[model samples]
Target chain A: MAEHPSSPIPGEKPRWLDQPRNVTKVVWALVAVCALLFLSDVLYEKHPTFAVEYLFGFYAIYGFIGSVGLVLAAKWMRTILMREEDYYDRDR
Target chain B: MTAIAELAMPISPGLIVILGGLLVPFLTAGIARVYVLLLSAATLVYVLGLPSGEHAAFTFMDLDLQLLRVDKLSTIFGTIFLIALFLGNLYAWHERDRMQRTAAQIYAGSAIAAAYVGDLVSLFVFWELTAIASVFLIWAAGTDRSFRAGMRYLIIQVGSGVILLAGVLFHVHETGSITFGHIGLGSIGGTLILLAFGIKCAFPLLHNWLQDSYPEATVTGTVILSAFTTKLAVYALARSYAGTEMLIWIGATMTAFPIFYAVIENDLRRVLAYSLNNQLGFMVVGVGIGTELALNGTAAHAFSHILYKALLFMSIGAVLFRTGTCKGSELGGLYKTMPWTTGFCIVGAASISAFPLFSGFISKSMILSAAGEEGHFITWAILLFASAGVFHHSGIKVPFFAFFAHDSGRRPKEAPWNMLLAMAVTAGLCIGIGIWPEPLYAMLPFPVDYVPYTAVHVITQLQLLLFAALAFTFLMRTGLYPPELRSTNLDIDWIYRRALPAIIRGLGSGIGVVWDSLIGGGRMLVSATIDGAARNFGPYGLIGRTVRVGNGVAWVATLLLVTLLIAYSAG
Candidate 1:
């Protein structure tokens, strides 16, 4: 949001979030969380209500794969669904 | 206190809002907020005082109508509706449009009426009223597109009401009862009623209306609209036709399909709209399960869903107001300027994605766990898959693209304090419910015995979310995520929006061509007939021959004489 007319903060103060380096920093933090969650999976008391719940890091793997699959599937769908923004009102 | 005690006895809580709404516009803007707040407060107080049984009934023609029902079920829904109305009105206090506030009141009133009704006729009446009143929200956008969307939204909403009315007629005729209660889809009437609820519940194919219309609404309008409509349908389904097994599949399908649509959708508001549908799927599954625990789960889920979804809509609405756009393609790195909005949005995102110590985790797990308990193994699996899918689009994609993605070079100002206050209140509820769900659990229609904070459950939930984040990171780093493009993605509304209109236009043109040829053909035929008549009877033709008058008279006389002569001879 660097270009809004309201946002030309005179002498724009530097913030931690604005630094591009923070992207890498956040990525590493996310990875560490994932790793810790994955490792801690074994120690948790297992209440496998469904057979699938018994699998190690099932939710983690499921989430990652499901998400990747969703994006890919949507990209494929865009071939059919994507149209000009004025698709419905082209005649207007 | 005595006056309120007397007032409570005379009417249903719903009418206070509907009637008060009529009087709201008379008040000056300065005290209008106080007036409206007190009105809602009175409604809540009245609802609290109403006995937990059918209270208000009257006869219309020969039909007995129960306008108010206050059981545990209605009580829970009523409480939430009042809560939502109060918060929604507070959020909209700064809005200048008098008509919109009036409409919002009517909308909330009708929803409360729908929740509290004890008979099919009353239900049907209030059902249509909600549809009619709430379309104003869509129209409040005051854009041509919103006008059209509001119109379509109204038609479908009314169609559901009509279907329900027809079903009620048949059901009453067959059973000799007008009570709104359990009936499976075993007869024509039952199936029709089921279809009605299905449409409103937005089961799969009938679901596109939610996505198409809600994003087109005015900012606060969308927040209010999000709370009542679908959740009302869920309540109706729970009231009348719980445990209908087909809802299992309908609910499952609802959960699964929207994530893909959400992924490619460019409007961040529309993405939340899809996310709303996905969350409804969870409630639908619970109603389908129909166990006491499941029904309680549905109620609790709806309660939290309303707050969090409204929170999401508020955050997005604030962005739209500040920057005049919510397109994913047009937004990024907003947190640099609008930090409060960004934080509240992430809270909303986290709640919807079922992060631990957030709202969705507590309510959604009950449904999933209940499905496993009931041996609906396959339904369980699909829902499990959909949970991850929900986290992907709603949790990661919404916040990531709007606040944290590559800078789109926009730095809009922070949302107004009122907007942030609204978001903060809702966000607080989301976390409060997550941290201590007992207050929410105690209010459920059925005793909610399920615990959401089991060690295994929290771990699994976190795993699901964090891994989804990893996948998002991977997609972003690899450039595999679909770039936000300014494009419209067609959905089922294409039937009415494009396909049918195109056909009508084709027919219109075809009819025009045929009409032109028919006019030409008729002219030729007319000319031919006129030419022949000219030769036979016109002044320029045989009649114009010399001595025509005398000769024609003589010819007629001779023919008459010949006929007489022949008759005499024959005799």
Candidate 2:
């Protein structure tokens, strides 16, 4: 009689579902760009010859790749290492 | 050898400062306060006016030696140390606590003395004096936390001095000269001395004490604590051990590690402390490379780092004074209330982040360029990464979280006038040095040749900034970046803060159990021995009989026979 009762007891949908679809799309697009940049950097063995040349390009490409890598790594790490903010407080 | 001789004055103006430091505590509070300020100011002026190449020496008892030498390097450090003391005294002037005032004076005096020391022994004495005097500032904060931090700080600092002493003794024994010079890193004594400097410089893991202690110090106490100790170490390193290759890597690690902790730390002052560690890393790397340009970078970076770091701490101290807490989790939207303090903090942030036309941009670029020129590709890359990380934590995170983030609904009044004035003076120095680095460069140990405004350096730096900003924006938009929430960050210091104490307590209890058993066994043994002795020697026992003359005669006859036999054998 109550097979689906827990599904909609009140307004209990996860918060992520509430955001606009465009936000998710943009995030994916950024992720894709970061992956593409990383692969390109690995394949290309050359750096710009002049210090001033391609400065913005190199930074943007590499910085984006690094930031994305950091985010994913941190997310992975949190599953193992993350503790409650007050973990030390109880002992105190 | 005696090319430039001066009158061997026993009580020079330098000694006057040292003596004044000792005498200040005995004076009335009002007079002591004025006298300390005046004395420090006079010392600053005297140091500034000292001829660049002047060297003086004095000896006592034909064994104790004293050398007070003033050169470009010593003068720059000594002068700044005096200025720092003056400002620090002014900041703490309202406190009637004699211990704080006297310790502050001694700390400053010793640092100034250390700056001008020309031999290993003199440097060692002044070095330990600095360690002893500065701990009082930490203790003056008058909290259990401050007490413990001060104790740890003192131990490490004094440990450094002890190491330095051992090194000096060995060096003197080997080289037969105690004169301080560019003793290359070729021997054990030299390496020990380098380690001593490394500890003070807060190289890598040795850095936690700085962050751990500086925040726990009294509000005014923290300002004085910031300037002298580590900078003196840097000066010593630059003077003695420049161009050591390991320093480059150690410096790089120092630059990189602190940013993560700073990024997540809840306490603002603690965050600044971590930033200070990161900034010192840049200076150390420069010293390690030891090119003329790199050394200039190290000196310039140190000069600017001291100013900006002090300014940042002063701003945070102002906030802490108004509000009881300096935790980022508990603070926001203070700009509307304490605009002056916020503005000053922003100047410090911009200068530290190396924004165009800021002090950091001019000085830090020198080191990065030096890294590139030296063909240290990995170090150059890491430093570039660290530059962005600095922007993330110190430049953007500090000011934004404290002043511009969502209002935490706590409205505090602006900082007092004196605090604002201090911030203003420091802010001025930050700007002054950035706009015209020639003065700072000229005062460096080596000649300055590289210009900071080259097109390649500027463009590359700008691109790095833009990309870092873009990355930050991207993360913020995506909600993937970790938000600045109220939290405590774990760092290498956690080892001492949590693990060390726990381990000590654990080991203590474990040992206590074994000790308790051992004591019990010993007591049992003692009781048994006493009982046996009682049974044997009491009136009722066999040995209790009065043997007297017969037993004595037998024992003496045996002894004499053995002695005669040994003598006959020798013959």
Candidate 3:
């Protein structure tokens, strides 16, 4: 077996950051930038006060509820629709 | 202009192009290739120069046949279809197979014809034409698997056309009109049309033919097959029925279901096939939402998808062409030798992933925003999850495994210049549309005011991406990632592949036993009748006994004398 690259430092166990450390850092940085930009748009963007209030309220409640419902529906479908990975194979 | 009109109005020219497709098989390979390309190119020019907002209907022998109508929506789809044909033709120019070339031309012609069709009858005719022409591409592989795949594809596709025909008949009976236009899905006829479109869209359960047949087609054949059929169905659905609440759920399922199959699929081309299904799901969702922005998104997504998806397929085809295999297990470290092909594949991957500054991001975001605008927070969120799933399969998985994973030590030569040229042109479109979407948006059937470059949209999409990427990394680091190997992944196609065939075989045998018993009983009855006849008619029978008649004669005479006396007294 090939030796692991970027092994854990002495007394410091490598977690998600152990391998491809620079790549992980870049990904996280991009994420942070996205979050900051989103917050700025939500708070500072120009809009009618009433419209903003209603839209954001809808986004919060409906988005969360809908996501949960989707997760549940997906789980239910997994039972009925899901099949063995090799379902189409002749040999299987 | 008046003098031009005075001259005999020439035939639609589109018909000529379609008819030319039929003659391709008789031509030599070199001539056929040039003829097919020139015909398609000319058709593209004809469709482009077609006058906008003009609707024409022709009747023959009192049949009132309406063909070749042009509108904004038809123009957009028709134009893109022509471009697709052009690219598909260029990609397949190296293929000397006569059947493939003929099928490709006919497929393009039928799609263009379908777009221009003015009435339901004309639409159905061209719709079935597209189906008939496309199946040859699948069969062109000349393999047992492809034959079976093509057969299933024919059944589902022809089934769709039949359903559409039934719907058209019902629709005409109910509405007393055969003109194709928006009709809500509240009646049986409307519902049937929706189902027909659903089959073509490869919606959820009806989606198996796409994944099953596409990968089984020849390399260039797959590229041509990718362009027309499903997208045409999307256009049809969006045209006739939109905002059907069920489509929302159906579309979401379509988007999400294929990722798992794609992740585990052994064949790279099959993976792309599944990915194609997943992308169609997004377009379906857009149609389901039925807002101006959403509809635009659907059209734009279809446009961009044809580019990048074709690019991806072409790259994989190049790999297959070089190595004679597209199984991921047999391919890795190819990037070291074929850097150009690898780079093109990555561009396709990034575009599909909706990475920042890609075509997918620009178009897909429109639908997401439309969902949010419509107060469909749940639908929007599911779409978000699907976005992440896209990253997992088409975006990351395709590139990572094919290019970087474990280096399987293969040194295949790069794709041919013609193939690379096809990929490059497609890649250029992907980037061009991503950077300047104005031209694409302008071509949409609806007016567009929504900006794609909004701070909120970009930022949220990025956050979703980052988290999804992080999830992927987390899975990999923890050894939870699904390993890439030569394993078959199952989808809805299994119903036809396994269950349906087994049922048919079982039914066949059961019928055979019943038939044997009926035949046995029938033989027994016939033989018994023949035996009885033989016994009565043979020389040993009572009717042939001449000596018995001589012995009875004397007794009869004695009895007759007494009877005659009694009869005389009665008289």
The DockQ leader among the candidates is 1
| Positional deviation of residue B388's Cα in model 2 after best superposition, in angstroms | 1.2
Task: Kindly list the per-residue Cα lDDT of model 3 for residues A46-78, writing each as its tens digit.
Answer: 432124333533322332343333334533445
Tens digits of per-residue lDDT, candidate 3, B264-306, equal 6678888898889889988988989988889989999988898
After superposing candidate 1, which stretches have Cα over 4 Å from the reference? A1-11, B1-10, B535-571
Q: Rate the local accuracy (lDDT) of all candidates.
A: 0.86, 0.77, 0.77
Report how closely model 2 matches the true complex, as a DockQ value.
0.11
Check candidate 3 and list the clashing pairs. A66-B378
Error of 3 at B183 (Å): 2.3
* Whole-model alpha-carbon lDDT for candidate 1: 0.86
The DockQ-derived docking category for candidate 1 is medium
Stretches > 4 Å off in candidate 3: A1-92, B1-16, B61-63, B511-571
| TM-score rank order | 1, 3, 2
Count clashes in each candidate, considering only residues at least 3 apart in sequence or on different chains.
5, 0, 1
Report model 1's chain A TM-score.
0.81
TM-score of chain B of each: 0.92, 0.86, 0.88
Docking class of 3: incorrect
Residue pairs in steric clash, candidate 2? none
What tens-digit string does per-residue lDDT give for candidate 2 at B134-239?
8998998888778988998998999999999888878877888887778768887898898898888888878878987899898988998999899999999889
